[model samples]
Target: MSKIVLARVDSRLIHGQVVTKWLQQSAANEIIVVSDELEQDEFLQSIYLMAAPPGVEVIIKGTESVKAYWENEAAAKNSKVLFLVPDLTTLREMVEAGVVKEAIQVGGLGGGPSRKNVVKNINLSEDDVEILEGLLAKNMEVYFQAIPEETPVPIHKLIEKYKTL
Candidate 1:
């Protein structure tokens, strides 16, 4: 069985921070990106797949496909893998599917209408707050931590600040 070293939500999925910082910090040898949209675009998939460091495997799959991959132990021989998703919606789907059930890292989200800058690099809209609150209700450990060096802001604190905005 594959162990999820970390599950992160970052809009810029395979950026510098993720490739250099989080990957080494988590000691994850494989990066499994779950995105329904990316699976349909081979060009984008190729870009992300090649972003990982040498020897670090990168597999792109959709929400449903990832679940199937998770179930099939033989699909990936690597033990520790990092799961990266683009947004809260996809994270919610993975969590509901029983694929991700532990700590969730909110890394980075770009600014948009109604999107409040909750943390250094993380921005959350009203819908994002609602989703985070729901996840918290389910006893999930969701937090905003851009990199491993910084202290992670808990979901409760993040939601409180979002409400104030």
Candidate 2:
């Protein structure tokens, strides 16, 4: 059966860090990017598909489609899947749909007017914090770590620091 070795949330979906570090670390042969917007753009979809390393397979699907895939075909394949979601909102929705049930790796969150920088490449809005906390409440291991080398900051620590900021 296919298994999701890594479930990560990164604003920049298929980037260098993902191709170089996380993919190798997770030992995932297939990348399943769950994004509603990206699924609609065939041009961008092609670009993302081409961005992956030669042997690795990349498939872009919308939230609902991914959930269905996980429930059906995903269980039959021998592939090790690397699940990627673009934002905390999508991450939360996927979890609620039962697509992602365990640990999460937060790589990058773009900075915005209402968002605060929680780490060098990580930013968080109020809603983002709430979504993460909700995941933690469900006993999900949520963490912020840029690469496999960087120390992973736990959800509780980030929430504690965000309150102080």
Candidate 3:
């Protein structure tokens, strides 16, 4: 079956690091971006479609679309699926909606007013940490890694280290 090879919450959606680092590392040929905005937004959809590698099929679908597609036989075939959400809330929604669970969760969260902690070059907030913890509590593997080479700090451990900050 086509398992979710990589699941990331990147505010930027599709960019260089994703095309080069995460996609290459995961060897994912298809990127299934689950975003309601992208589904209805032709401009955003075009941007992502052009940003992704030509060989890689980038399918932008709404949350409901994913839930339906994953249940189909075509999506069950052996394919590397990457789900890109803008934030943990969307991830939580996907899980709550009965969409397929990811084997691992990676955070590529970018800079924003909503997110600002500079945890080893990766910005984070207490709320973000709490969401990560919640996902971990649900038995999902969670970690913060900018790239594959950087030491992946466990979300739970990081929360303990910077909870007081």
Looking at model 2, the pairs that clash are none
Q: Write the per-residue lDDT of candidate 2 for residues 41-71, one digit (tens) a residue.
A: 9999999998999999898999888888888
- Candidate 3 per-residue lDDT over residues 1-165, each given as its tens digit: 677788887777788888988898998988888888889999979989999987888888888787787778435677787778877777877877756476545556666676656475456777777777778889887777777778877777767765656
Q: Runs in model 2 with CA error above 4 Å?
A: none
Model 2: ten consecutive residues of lowest lDDT: 155-164
Q: What TM-scores do the predictions have? A: 0.94, 0.97, 0.85
Clashing residue pairs in all predictions, respectively, total 0, 0, 0
Mind giving the per-residue lDDT tens digits that candidate 1 earns over 97-163?
8899879999887899879987777788888888898899898999888888988888789788888
Q: Which candidate order results from sorting by TM-score in descending order?
A: 2, 1, 3
Q: lDDT of candidate 3 vs native?
A: 0.76
The Cα local distance difference test for each model comes to 0.88, 0.90, 0.76
